[model samples]
Target: MQRDYFDRVHFWGRISSVTALAVMLGIPLSISLHFGIWPQAAGVLNGLLKIIPMFWSIAVIEVLTYAPLLGAGGTYLSFVTGNISNLKLPCAINAMQNAKVSPSSEEGEVISTIAVASSSITTTLIIAVGVLAFSPLLPVITAEDSAIAPAFKQVVPALFGALGAGYFSKHFKISLVPIAAGVLILLVFPALPVGTLIPVTVIISLLGAHLSYKHTQKKEKKRQNQA
Candidate 1:
């Protein structure tokens, strides 16, 4: 168990470290390119120099908050591992028929569940705070001219729309609430303060999700009665 824990810790630590580095490097490079801060040939080197200190600062902060970060990283790692392990379910079942113990045990289930919850809570809080705090700096980094800055602002909404579309494609019937909620938010956004937008968006999404759940439950019950 200790060995397995160590392996998982090392694996996820490396993964997060690499991901953070790539993001730190990529964002500054992209911003520099967007803003024409350097000639294309020198952009990467300049961006690297500019971003290294910022990345180091973030690393230091994460190390100081290692407890929460590790809890979250471990949760995600366990989830991914569990998913991969489950994919081998058919073979595992076949082996289990002749074996003394099953590969999928109660303890594994408990561990995965706990890891997922803890990781999710910590990671979400960290990301939410980070984004809020860093939002102002984004324009500074990415802005080339006033025109370009406004264009960059469209990226977030476009990305969100694509995500919403993917979600709707997977669950078509439940999509309308989110669509309507988004429309309402956009309609009211001009009058709303920027500070209120995030909370409003959250409320709308939550209400949409609740409505979708109730709708699905009602449909399921109707089908059951019909049967």
Candidate 2:
């Protein structure tokens, strides 16, 4: 019997997810058993207490926000693969855009999957090559006297600047208030814990964008009425 397409995806996704989770758990479990030692209960609880309270909300928010954009396969693969924001997502989006595939369509799912796969492959190969070359390249890249080391440090900011310029140019109106708010929040509350800060910033940004969109709609309607 032919199953629905999503049913198949869901089936595979669950199997893959479970297998991956098992493998991840297996490694530490094996080590613990081999060493005849387990992590301290208090240590585990303290770590979990700090992390879960902060991260659980952010995880929920990310799942709610990104799941519709990333279909079943992409979502599953992305969760396993990580780097959704900076790498996988942008590559998938660019592939979909270049192919003129609507994100909501099956074709877009294939395109996104292919794009992320290719990106992962390329990243892996690059890392492999870097590993092979590391002994020779290490001094050149890491020496305090090496100019290249400084350049590597700047790469992240340069990337953010380029991406920020592109995004903000298009979304300046909807983004400006949130951007300002985020900066102010950071400046005023430098001690804000990461777990609290991320979700708060995201909420602020979402609210700002929504209000901006509504304001623009209202302005358009007013103009149309006057016309």
Candidate 3:
């Protein structure tokens, strides 16, 4: 049954990913066709040359870093719906933590998928409403001396800060290396993009967690032998 379930997931996941890619490309293609304003090959190539390396590298890194935590279904949904790091990821992680499920387990897969789906739906609805109401709210939000300007700018940082505080507080030993490395990287290479930074931090965190686990195991073994 598990095998069959996974087979189905892979089938649908691939379908969804390909379809999303097609749709994404279709929009620009359609626009060019309708306007009869196709871009020059040289211009297109130049743009791709600049962005492809950064975008493609980040794409691969995100898949590697997020797949283990999000499970198959969640990953497919997240990649399609977008906003994985800021919204879907936090939702899935919080859901799994609340449900007390391991991400590698079937139960976790279901929970993560559901969480991502919920986040996607909520985000879509919010975007739709915001679009409708944006004109009315724009003036207040964009006022030169708006009191909430700083707060608005801090939203992403606040979200990550809250999540980081919770996780780091609980797993300080394992988080130490990643946190230190992240700070050092920022200090040394302040221009590093977040797409590259995330995977590097994740790798360091994994190594730190592994070492911490091994140390605990050795201490337990020593105590058992002495007893």
Task: Supply every candidate's count of residue pairs whose N, Cα or C atoms clash at under 3 angstroms.
Answer: 1, 0, 0
Q: Backbone clash tally for model 3?
A: 0
CA RMSD of each candidate after superposition: 16.1, 4.0, 1.9
Model 3: CA > 4 A from native: 139-144
The C-alpha lDDT values of all candidates are 0.53, 0.76, 0.89
Off by over 4 Å in 1: 1-71, 74-153, 189-195
| Alpha-carbon TM-score of each model against the true structure | 0.33, 0.73, 0.91
Better of 1 and 3 by TM-score: 3
lDDT of 1 by residue, 9-120 (tens): 6686678767766876798689878998855657667878997986676545434432232243333343333321222222222233334332344334334334454545
Q: Which stretches of candidate 2 lie over 4 Å from their true place?
A: 1-4, 33-52, 55-57, 93-108, 132-140, 143-145, 191-198, 222-227
Put the candidates in TM-score order, highest first: 3, 2, 1
Q: Model 2 over residues 120-221: C-alpha lDDT tens digits?
A: 778778778888978687777788888777887786577557666766776777767766787788899988864456556667888888887899899999
Cα error of candidate 3 at position 95, Å: 1.2
Best by lDDT: 3
Q: After superposition, how far is residue 19 of candidate 2 from its true place, in Å?
A: 1.4
lDDT of model 1, residue 151: 66
Q: Which structure is stronger by TM-score: 1 or 2?
A: 2
